[model samples]
Target: MGYGELIIRSYDAQNDRGRVEDFERRCEVGPAKRVFLFTDTLGDPMCRIRNSPIYKMLVAELDSQLVGVIQGSIKLVTVHKPPNDLAKVGYILGLRVAPLYRRRRIGLSLVIKLEEWFIANDVDYGYMATEKDNEASVKLFVDKLGYAKFQTPTILVNPVGHRRFRISPNVELAKLKIEEAESIYRKFMSSAQFFPIDIGNILRNKLSLGTWAAYPRGESWGEVPSSWAMLSVWNSGELFKLRLGNAPFSCLMYTKGSRFIQKLLPCFKLPGIPDFFHPFGFYFIYGVYGKGPLSGKLVRTLCRFVHNMASSKSKDCKVIVTEVGGSDTSRLHIPHWKLLSCPEDLWCIKALKNEERENLHELTKTPPSRALFVDPRDV
Candidate 1:
C-alpha cells in the first residue's frame, strides 16, 4: 500500500452507500478492553450531516475499494473573541478507516483532504472530538495535524428503563413552541462558544422532539422566571443504533441480577439496567441552560421528564445522553450512570488560516467556559 496508490474523492451515495456502510461496521469505537461500540447508521451514511447548513463527505480509495471516510460541516458560530465574537468554523466528524488500513496513513489522508475542503470554503477553523484516552486519534489530530486540545466535555448517559419520576409539584413544566424555543436560546445562549447561528432550523427539524422549560408554577414563557431551566431533545435514536462490545463479566452480572430482581419483585419497581450488549438507541439532550439557586432542581426535573417520555414512547431507546463541558455547573444536575458516562471527552481545534492564529492561540490558552454548546447534529 504505497502512498501514491491511495486516492481520495468525494463520496457518491448511489455508488458508495453499501461499501461505506460496510466500512462503518468494521470501525468500532472505544477501547477494546472494556466496551467498544459501533454505530449502525441504518443504511444512510449521510444521515448525520445531511441536516447541516453546509456539509460534505469524502472517501478514500485503494485499488477501487473503500478504505476510509470522513465527513465535515461548515457553519458560522460564536467564539466570543475580541473584535469578532463569531467565526466561520468547520466540524470534522465520522472519520473512519477500514480495520486493515490502520497506521497506513489512510486516516491522515482523509482528514487532510477534508481540511482542504474546509479551507477552500474560507472556513476559519476546523475542530473534532474524540475520547480522551484515544491516543491514536489524539496524536493524529493534535501531534501531527497541529490541532490544539481545546475543551474537555463530559458525556452524561442515563439509561431509560421502566422508571418514571414524579415532577416536583411546585415546579411547572411547559413545552416551548418552536418560536419560543429559538427566542429563549438566542437570548440566553448566544454568548456561549459554538452556539449555532441557525438554532431555529435545529428546533424546527423533525428529529427535534421539542424544547421544554421548568420553573416555578406561577411563572410562564411570557415573563421569564428568575429561577428556571430549559433544554431540547434530539431523536438520535432514529439516526443510529449503538452496541456495546467486550463487556466485563461483572457488568454483565450486574445487568442480569438487576433485571432478575426487578422481575421477581414487581412491586419494588427497580430500574434494571438495559442490556447494552445488544444494539440500542438513545435520545440526546442539548441546549441545556439553567439559572438561580433552584435551577439545578429544574434541570433535574427536565431530565426526569425526558426519561419518562422516552420510556413510555419507545422500547428501542435504552439511554438518554447529554454532553456538557467538564466544568459546567449544569452537570451536577443531569442524571447519569457513572459506569456508562465519559468524564473527559476531548475536543481539538486548529486554525486554517494564518490570520486566525491569534484567535486560535487565545482560545487554546483560555480554559473552556461552562457555556460550551454541544451541537445535537454533531452527536
Candidate 2:
C-alpha cells in the first residue's frame, strides 16, 4: 500500500471524491471550505477541467487513497495568421498533490502522465499557467520539462455596483449570437487563447448568461463600426461559494485594499441573498476584447453595460473579474480594485512532436505590449 503500490488512472469520482477533498484542503492553507470555487456544471469533473473538447483527468492512488490529481485539455487556437493557420495546443491545469506526498516525485509523475495524455491526443504544443512565486510548479514545468516562461498576466477583480450601473446613454451594448460574435472576434482579436471554433461551447454553457459586444452610439454592430468591445458573463453565485474558514478578511487584502474594503462593506461577498444564492454571487466576465483606437472607451462602455446588466438581473451580482497579461495595455481600460494581487502568473510552454516547421507561430511570435485576451473560459 506504499510507494510501489501507487496507481495513476483516469478520475473515478465515486471512489476518489473523499481523497480529492483531503488533497484540496491540505494543499490550500488559509481557509479550507473557501477553496471550492463556483463554476458551471457543479460537481462535474469536466467542469473542473475547464470544459474542453477533449480532456483527461488523472489521479494517483496509494493504498486506495487519492494522493494527486491533474487535468489537461486540447484546443485548436487560431494564431496571428488564419485561413488554415491553426495550432493544436495542449493546456495543463488543476495539478495538485497531497501534502504528505510532497518531495516524493509524485507531482512530477502526474505531470509526465498528463503530458503523455496530451501527446496521445495529437497535440502540437503544450502549455500551462502558474504563479511566478510557485517555485515547485515553475521548476516542474520549466527546468524539468523544458518549457519556457511565455506570458505574465495580471488578473483584476472589478466589482459591479452603483457606479457601473451608470452607463452612458451614448454607449450601446448589443447581445450577439455565437456566429456573429466569433466572426468579429476572429477578425479583430489576434492574441485570444481559445479558437473561435469552440466559443459556442463556452457561450452555451449553463452557467454563462450570455455574450455581448459594445459599439459607440450612432455606430452599431455589423455597421461601419469605428471600434468594438465584447464580454461574456458567468453566474458564479449560482454555482458555489468561498467559505474562508477562520482566516481574517484583513489578511486576504494584500495591497492598498481601500477600494475592496469600501465595496465589501455591503457584504456583497457574503452568501445568501434574495436570489436564493447561499454564497456571494457575481458575474465572472471572460472572452473580452477591445479593438480600435477608441477601444479604451469601448472597453469602459462594455464593462459598465455588463455590470449594469448583471445588477439588474441579480442584486447579488457585484463584481466582474478577468485576467490580462502585464504587458497588455488593455488593463488600463478594464477597471479593478486592488484588494490583492497574486504573484505574477507565468504561462510556460513547450513544443510537441511532428509539429509543422513553418506554421509554429505559437513558438515563433510573442504577444505585443497591448491588450491580450486570455479567455477565462479556458480556466
TM-scores of the models, in the order given: 0.96, 0.80
Which residue ranges in model 2 land beyond 4 Å of their true spot?
29-42, 80-84, 161-164, 190-196, 236-240, 243-282, 315-318, 341-343, 354-371
lDDT of 1 by residue, 1-379 (tens): 3544899999999999999998888888776665789889999999889989999999999888788999999999998677899999999999888877789889999999999999999999999999999988999999999999988999999999886888889999899899988988999899998999999999999999999999998777567688999999999989889998778899899999999998899799977889898889899999999988899989999999999999899889999999998889999999999988999999999999898988887898887764989999898
lDDT of 2 at 59: 91
Query: Which structure among the candidates has the greatest TM-score?
Result: 1
Native-referenced Cα lDDT, model 1: 0.91
Clashes in candidate 1: how many?
0
Please name the candidate that would achieve the greatest lDDT relative to the true structure. 1
lDDT of 2 by residue, 1-379 (tens): 4465768899877976656655655565322343333222334544545556787889988777778888888887754433454678788887877777778888888888888888888887788887677677887888888787767878777655554356778777788887776666667664454344566666777887777877788885767578877877776656543333343454445312544554567455332112111345566777677778887888877777776776667766656677776776667787676753342667877777654534444443655434456654554
RMSD of every prediction:
1.5, 5.2
Give Cα distance to truth, residue 245, candidate 1, Å: 1.4
- The TM-score obtained by model 1 is 0.96
| TM-score of candidate 2 on Cα atoms, chains taken together | 0.80
